[model samples]
Target: MKKLLHFLFHSEVPDINERYRKVTSAFVVIFIIGYSIGFLQLLHLGPYLGPGLGDNVSFQPLITSLQALHSQNPSLWYALIALLCVTVSFRLLVMLAGYFLFEREEGSAYPIKWIIVFFLCNLFSTLTIPLLLFALATLFWVSGLDFNLGWQWIDHNVRLANQLVVNHVPTLINAPAPIAVLMIAIISGFFHYWFHRLGHTQRILWLLFHRPHHMTPALMQSTTMAVFTALPLFFFIILPYNLIFGACTKLFSSEPLYTEVIIFNCLILIPEIFGHHTALYQIASRNQLIRLASFISGGGVYHYMHHSSEPEHCGRSGAVNLVNIGGGPLFIWDIVFGTYCPLSAKTPRAGLSGQPELHMNPIRLTLAGLAQICNELYRNPSWREKWRIVIGSSSYTPTLSTDFAIKSNKIRQEQATPNPATIKNFTFSAPADAIASVAAKPVTGPQS
Candidate 1:
C-alpha cells in the first residue's frame, strides 16, 4: 500500500495508474457499445410535448413523406450514385494517392476511424434531424407560420437575381455554354457565400449548428471531416448540391445539362471536399490546371486555413470558420470581409484545437454545443445574462456570479489549485490540500 501511494504521488512516471486507465477505457467501451445498439430506435428526441401538452403531435406523417420522397423518386438514386462516385469514392482514391505521392507527415492520424465516425454520425443525423425539422415545421404549421415560404425565399432570390442578370446583361443570358455556367456559378456562389458565412459567423448558428465541423481533429482522414458537421460534410453536402443544382438546372434549362452539373459540382464543392484533405490540397495547389480553375474562388487552400487549428486562423479569437469563410467565387467576399487568408501565407495544419471531447461520442458531439450552452445558462443566474448566453457570442461568458462579487477565475489561476469536482481523480491528501487552497483563496471583485 505504501509503495503504491509512493508510486502514485511521488513517482517520476506521470502515468502511474493503470487502474484509472482501465476504468476510463471501460466507460468509453460501454458508451460506444450501448450507443451503437440503441442509435436506431433509442436515438429519437421528439414527440416532445404531445397529446397532453399539445394534442395529436405526430412525426409519422413527416417521417413517411421523407421515406416516400426517396421511394418516390427513382432519378434521385441515379443522382445520388453519381454524386457518391465523384465525392465519396473520389475521396477514398485521393487518400490512396496521397499515401503514394507524398510521405505522410508524422503524427497524421490514418483517418479510418474518423471516417467511420463521420458515416455513423451522418447516419444518425440523417435519420433524426430532418424528422426534428419536419416536426418543428409541423408545429409552426399548427401555429399558422408559413415555414415553406421561408425556404422558398431562397428560390425567389435566385429568380430575382436571374431576372436582373437577364435584364441588365442580355448577352449574359444567351452567352456561350461556358459563360452561362460561369454566371450560374457566380450567382450560386454569391448567395451561398452569405448563407454559408452565417453558419460560421453568427453566434447561434456557429454554436448550435456549425462548430462541430471545426471540431474535427484531422482533415486528411479524407477531408470528409464532419460535413456530418457544420450534417457534417462530404457525401451529404455534395449529394444535396448535385441534387438541388441538377433539379434547378432542369427547372431552368430546356434539357439536362449533365456536363454543366459535373462542372458546377467541382467548382462549388472543391472547397468543401478537397480543401479539407491535406494531400489533395498539396496536389491541387501544385497542379496549374486545378489552380487556374479555382483561382478566383476560395478553393482548397482557402478552406484549409479555415480548419487550421492555429489561433489566428480561428479569425474571431475563439471562433473558427471565420478565415476564408466562403468558397468558389466567394473568395472575393472573404477578401472584402477581411476573412480571406492565402495558401502561400502559411502552411496550415487542419483539425480542431482544445476540443477532443467533440470527437468522443457522435450523439453527444452533435448536441455538445447545445449542452455547453445549457451548462452556461445553468451557471448564470440572471435571466438577462442567460438570454445573452443564448443570443450573444458563443465566446461570451457572464462576468458576474449572482449578487455576490467574485474574482474566482483569477484567484484559481494564481493559486494553481485543482477543482473540487475533479478531486475524485486524485489522492485523498491532494484533494484535502486542494480544498484548503480553495478555501484560503480570496474572492475579490467590484462591490455589488
Candidate 2:
C-alpha cells in the first residue's frame, strides 16, 4: 500500500528548450490553402447555398430563440459579447501576471510562434468548422436527408430521463433550485470525467482528437483553448452533454436556468484558465485550505501534472495516465475513481515526449497529426496489447516504466536519418566529359 501511494505521487522533471524552430514551408502552404478554402466556403458560398439548398424547418427553434433574445432586448446581444471578451481578457491577464510574478525563472519561455498557432487553430476549429457544417447540414436537409443522423437515440434517452424525474420522482422535483443545480453539476462532471478518460485510453480517439492538445511543447494561458479536434467529436460528445444538462435543468427548475448556467460557466472558466497556466508557482508551505481544495477538485496544479510527458504518469496504453485527473469545475469524480493526482506529486514534462520539434503552422500540424493517427491505427502493435487489457486477458498493473519512451526516442532518431543503402542509391553520377569540362572551367582565378 505504501509502495502504491509513493508511485501515485511520483513526479519526473521535464525537459526545457530555449530555442524553438520556425514553422516549416509545408506547414505554411497547407495553412494558406486550408484557410483560403474555408474562408471562401463559409463567407461567399454558404449564404448563396443556404437559400437554394434548404428550408429552415429544423432550425426554427434556433431562429425563435434568437428572435426571443432580440425582442427581450436588442442590447443584450452586445452585452453578452462584451461579457465574453471581458471574461477571456481577465483570465489571460491573470495567467500572465501569475507567470511573470512567480514562475518566470523556472517556466519555459512563451513562444510567439506558438501563440499565433494557438489562435489560428482555435479560429479554424471554433469558427470555420461550425459555419461550414451549418451550410452543409442545411444543404443536406433541403435534399431530404435526415440532419439529426440518429442523434434521436440520445435525445430520446434525455427526454425519457427528464420525464421520469418530473413525473415519478416527487422528492427530486421538490428539491431546492440550488440542490438541483448541484445534482446536475455532479452528473455533468461524471460524464465529463468518463468522456475525457475514454479519449485518453481509446487509441483511435486519442490519435485523431486529443493528440493535438498534447502536441504543444510548452503550456501558456492560450493553451486552454488550443485544442484541435475533429468536428464529429463536438457533435457526438459535447453537444450530447449540453443537451442532457439542458434537459435536466428544464425538468428540475420552474424558472429559467440562464443565471445558473452563467454562474457555472464562470466558475468552470476559473479552473480551466489556471489549469493551462503550467508555470504557476507552488509554495512549499501550502495552506491547509488550498490543499483540501486541490484534493477535492483537482485544481490547476493537478491538471498541470496531467500534461506531464512521463511514462510512469501515463496509463497502460502509454498515451495518457490511467490516473487521469480531469474533471469539470469540481473534480469529485476523479477523487471517487482514484484518478486524482494531488499537488504534492512532482511535476513532469509537458507535451508529447520523443516528438520531433513540430512546425508552428496550425493547419499543417493538424493534417500531419491526423496522418500520424491513421498510421498508428493500422501499424501500431499496442492496439492488441490495449485490447488484451480491455478483454481482461491480462491483469492490469500501473508502474513507472520508460520502455515506451525509450523506444519512441529511438524511432524518432531513426526517422531523422536516411538509410545508408538508400543514400548510396541516390548518389549523384556525372559523365566523365561533364566532370572534365567543369574541372577545366573552375581553374579561373581573380584578376586582381
Candidate 1 regions exceeding 4 Å error are 1-92, 98-103, 107-116, 130-177, 221-259, 266-272, 279-281, 286-289, 312-320, 344-346, 353-359, 399-448
For model 2, the run of ten residues with the poorest summed lDDT? 44-53
Q: lDDT per residue, candidate 2, 1-448, as tens digits?
A: 9986444323222332434323432343344344322322222111101111111224343334445666787886556445545645555555555434433635434554565666566666667455655665677678888765332433443454545444543333645756655665565556567666655655445544565676665665454344434533544453444344444454455444443343334434444444555555242103343333333343544566566665443222242343434654345665465454334233355666444465555554454434543444445457554353233211121121111222233333102111333223321223332223222322122110
* Tens digit of per-residue lDDT, candidate 1, span 200-289: 544555556666566555554322424433432222233333333333233233332333443344344433445666555655654554
Clashing pairs in 2: 314-321, 315-320, 315-321
Q: In lDDT terms, how accurate is model 2?
A: 0.44
At residue 364, candidate 2 shows an lDDT of 48
Q: Pick the candidate with the highest TM-score.
A: 2
